[model samples]
Target: MNQKQEIQEGLWDEEAAQTYDSNEGVFAPEVLRLTVDRLAALAGPGKALEFAIGTGRIGIPLAQRGVPVSGIEFSRPMVARLREKVDEARIPVVVGDMSEATAGEEGSYALVYLVFNTISNLLTQAEQVACFRNAARHLKPGGRFVIELWVPELRQLAPGLQAVAYQTTDEYFGIDRFDVVSQHVTSYHFHFGAGKEARLFRSPHRYIWPAELDLMAQLAGLELESRHSDWDGGEFTADSSSHVTVYRLPE
Candidate 1:
């Protein structure tokens, strides 16, 4: 299989899926609330879709707010967790890969969202651009597509300096070794516990600037509506830690 498929399959592996939420708490309720609020304000109680809605981190809460919500997820274990959450709260979800999800069933959504740097999972330009097309197809005219991703500038290291990076709270550590010759960064993560183990997840993402993302949206027949540096609607600037970008479907 190709690298992208391997990455995708590995993510859905039962063991990995079970521990995924704990590994990534950046999308906890507080962060998700901010995302839902912004989209709700813009879309005004219309239908919504959450791509890669792993464990319903964002989808369940949005559904509780009385918005009709549907989600597409690839991992069966992740979807099982989402199903449990949905059963507890009466939400609906679909099991499928976000990149290939057709625009049927629920018809179109006023707002469709993907968060927490999940877009990078594609690991290729073709897949990423196809994601944009799929999102557009699933959106109604004048709808909005929102995405939350890291700025990618945070990985920059100073000359002649090296440091260790932590992925989780005392759970995983990585040695971030830089290769100046190749202009690439590689991190080797060690999972700490009884019988220490190591796993390597690496990718070369072309950290596109906000302007560049806007251009991508334009190419997909979407327009930028707003851009923020954080979940709290802070103005985007060079020093921003993350980006919350909102794009609109043509009327």
Candidate 2:
């Protein structure tokens, strides 16, 4: 297997795909309502394509709202899980790396979206830039590309600290170890279940700031349209922890 395939398997194999759907907090109706509403509005009358469309989490609901949606995914296991929810005719998915893969013919989509910090999964600057270029290639002249990413929380760390605990609870613990010089971060998740059952998952990423993300988009012939703190159009501020940014290709 190639490097990309290895990464996909390491992070999203069959077991991970099965466990992914068990997160009730992430799949709640209230949480999905706003996200689907915003994406549907952005899709307008044309089709939308989702990069890394894991288990059809967002794509399925967005399609249910009357927008034509397709996806590009690297993990066959994850795609199989998605297939269990919807058929190929309703929501076709091509198995490939999003960084350089083509989901369909060029200029066929009105919107392209990457969510939940998936861009950082590329783990390299070149790959992330290529993913932006790939999105531009698949979009119509007036199409929009959207991304929802968390702002790096290095500021929360003390002067000499390299790690930050983002979540701590009775059943779960989450921490991120940061390498400031390299912009590399590894998130460590520890889950504890009943009867002494425990599990750990680690995912590495290359975190990008908003300014640098805009530069990548510019390199791909896309212009920044708007940025917000969330899907509800909250203003993006210095204190915001995450952002929803939209970029547009010239008409």
Candidate 3:
């Protein structure tokens, strides 16, 4: 894993951070809302931790639902934005590498969550495994660790299909280019009008299968409790677009 590339690609800078939330609403808000609803059912009143809690997209709403939430984020600008939505005194936001973040004053939580394919930000197998281990360390006995990510198989492109484009808005556009041989995915974003600019970001993710994730959890002393295809609890199948995996530490 190229640690430098991972950090540079995943962590948006101050100028880009300013418009991230607005551009993110194209898909993030609705997807995260669904995640919150699902977590609310499982978390109840228990304390929760959000890994890579970018701009409080999921953490803020979860807190609003009455869950005490803390977060670990690598990007300073993103955490800064999160603080604007919720007070730091109320929601503790720790700025550090997610894979190495220890349970500090917030203590262990009943639920530790990583969403929106954020696991891909780790970029290396060792880092990803370390993230699992760290998550286990931050969980109370029998606590749950939840992850929401797009099934990697979705990136498979047909012959002659080099780029996939999604229109986010009249001015803003999202373009994803596939590099199957290199096992790399690059997303080029274009913003028009006042916030007009073009930015290129690349993330290298090992698209592990569901069974592989289960194995990783087992290796970390966590048990795979549930695997759903979507946030709504649909059955996971070959054709599922997303995987919502839940793992639990032994009591």
Candidate 4:
């Protein structure tokens, strides 16, 4: 990847922070348990580092399971939300961009993970590659780097269609505006409630193909160790909407 492209950062304000935990699609117990269980198994007795560990979603639970977990997160509001559940002593976090931040000893973690499509928040291919390298830098030799991400569904976009309403429910409505040529999307989420005001959140992302992510890992000196369609190690096939992929540094 070219190293000179100007990177775009995300804005995680109070609204974004406050509503993060309300996403039942992700924050539901069963949803979180699978992720925590799988990560804990990979973590063994060693430490795990999280990139963009928003509100300690996975970090806190993983740490509680006896795997030391630290994190790098850029949003103050998000960090504040995390503090509500656990103090810094429980799941320590570094406040900076995950692509450029350090949270623990170099090459000291048994696993480094970025989940919930957080890698897409980097907004540029170069920064995404840097994030992979950062994960590698934080990993012990032969340690794992794992990520959860949605596969790009550009095929759903009809000609001249720049936007798609990917989700609509009684409580939530979500849409994504596509920049197909640029591999970027700006997602808009409108949330509803029972007799309460509607809430809106907007986030930008740069999508990457699985092959492109593999190349990034290769550049970071990490090799693809495994990939599954979900947290439970389901087979990855053409129809899967998302994937959990793990890579490893040379032992």
Best by TM-score: 2
How many residue pairs collide in each prediction?
0, 0, 0, 0
lDDT of 2 by residue, 1-251 (tens): 87866876889989889999998877988878988999999899999999999999899999999999999998899999999999999999999889988987889999999998999999889999999999999999999999999999988999889999999999999999999999999999999999989999999999999999999999999999999999899999999999999999999
For model 3, residues 1-251, the per-residue Cα lDDT tens digits are 46564565455667646766875452476777788898987776788998988788788888999999889987788878877888887788888778887646433688999987888766666778888888988888878999987765444566778677744877767766766665455566666666545555444455555776788788889999999988878999888878999999999
lDDT of 2: 0.94
For candidate 1, report its TM-score.
0.81
Looking at model 4, report the run of 10 residues with the lowest lDDT sum: 1-10
lDDT of 4 by residue, 105-135 (tens): 8989999999999999887788899999999
Candidate 4 residue pairs that clash: none
* Candidates 3 and 4 compared by TM-score, better number: 4
Cα RMSD of predicted structure 3:
3.4
Q: How close is candidate 2 to the true structure, as a TM-score?
A: 0.98
Ranking by lDDT: 2, 4, 3, 1
Top lDDT hit: 2
> How high is each candidate's TM-score?
0.81, 0.98, 0.83, 0.93
Q: Looking at candidate 3, what is the lDDT of residue 167?
A: 49
- The local distance difference test score of model 4 is 0.89
Residue-level lDDT of model 1, residues 1-251, one tens digit each, is 76665666765678666766775456676777787787677657678888888887777777878788777787778878777656733655667778787534533789888887777666555666777777888888988989888664435666576543534546666555544443234446566665655555443433445676677788789989888988789999888878999999988
